[model samples]
Target: MAKANVKTVEKAVEKVVNLPAGEKIERDGGEVTALDAASIRLVMQGWEIRKKIDELDAQLKSINAQLIEAHGAGASLVVHGVCRASIAEREAVKITNAERLKAVLGFRFTDLVKTEIAYKPEAKLIEMAADGDEPMAPSIRECLTVGKSASVTWRAEK
Candidate 1:
């Protein structure tokens, strides 16, 4: 795995030390003389922030997996229903629409499911949602509708 270029406590301290004089170097012991000491607080804070980010990433991955599974199951049910409706009612048009839906919402969705989904490209749906409009699937299906757009918040869903 690729490591992040994080500024550790030591690095932070080094930065402060390297800076020209006339700048304040406040520390708990009434001002720090060494770079290592200066970095102590900053390093701890950075570590905490990194830990939180890792935890959030794990949670997000789990949620994305669940969403992908749910979407897959939903697609399967829809497909089965379309097959049954087509056979019983002989509604070829409905079958065609169902096939299209499967291709778009089911098959296409799998490709989009991932650990992180960004939605900047799906500005239309976001805009609609911001405008107090209900953002349904088909409305935003064209733009990164799968994993790329899956990382949405509870507020966005509501």
Candidate 2:
């Protein structure tokens, strides 16, 4: 396959950016405003690039799975200058009948058991809290801490 000419795309983008606002350009047997054309082109190019990336990622995952199946976990091998593949085993605990175990063991198993507290306030609850209204749930009021954060969201106009 021939290599893509990245310079051509860059030049097209520069032309669109330099065009005055509300100026229209003629292309593809139709006239479109420079901003509109550029926006459409960017979204199309983004989708094409994302599709190619997803395809390559799926192929790589399949090859990795095959390697792991053939050699088993904790397998490592180098393939010349390309890359090295390694699979390692991980240990995890699976709990069954936590309440029954806790009941039978009583205080002796207290060290093995852990308690975690987290607070997720609802929009209405946040507003109520700001106005000094107590939370309906005591646990929520005990663990809740209000804070502010800044974030930005971007999406295609469609």
Candidate 3:
């Protein structure tokens, strides 16, 4: 990015981060931050923030359960006009036994159910194909797409 754009971003961050509590700020959609730094301070700061957020989220789940137990579903609580908590109820169906449901539904199964397809590589066929000594089905080989993915993990050092 241009020097002017980078400066503008720094000024915006300063303004947002320095905002007073109880004030709301709307943010627009954007990509990752423009600059990257090798500083250990920034790396540790980000990891610590992530850990704190995760801890708070877990705590909130337990608190939410307690609220539901005390007030029951459809009960809403307004907290000092700042926030509200409610358990929204909805009906959703899940098939517990696929074979049993299919048999029970009979001809109606095809009309009611939607099918999902997935593929996994066959290790024996792949090995044989690699050696070029045994014949492998062209249909099976054509269905396979080989690829790899990578990810990064960060945690507090003990």
lDDT of 2: 0.53
User: Which should have the higher TM-score, number 2 or number 3?
Assistant: 3
lDDT of prediction 1: 0.42
**TM agreement with the true structure for every prediction:** 0.27, 0.45, 0.46
Give the per-residue lDDT of model 3 (tens digit) for 41-140. 4655788899999999898777876776677666566665366665544432333444554554467455545545522223443443355554433433
RMSD values, in order shown? 20.0, 18.1, 20.1
Worst ten-residue run, lDDT, model 1? 85-94
Worst 10 residues of 3 by lDDT: 149-158
Question: After superposition, which runs of candidate 2 have C-alpha atoms over 4 Å from their true positions?
Answer: 1-35, 108-110, 117-158
Clashes of each: 3, 0, 0
- 42-85: candidate 1 lDDT, tens digit per residue: 66678899999999999977865665555532222223323211
lDDT of 2 by residue, 1-158 (tens): 12356877777889777744654568776776545766666766888999999999898777766766777666666666565656655532223344544454466334544433522334544343345554333432333444432222222231
Pull out the clashing pairs in model 3: none
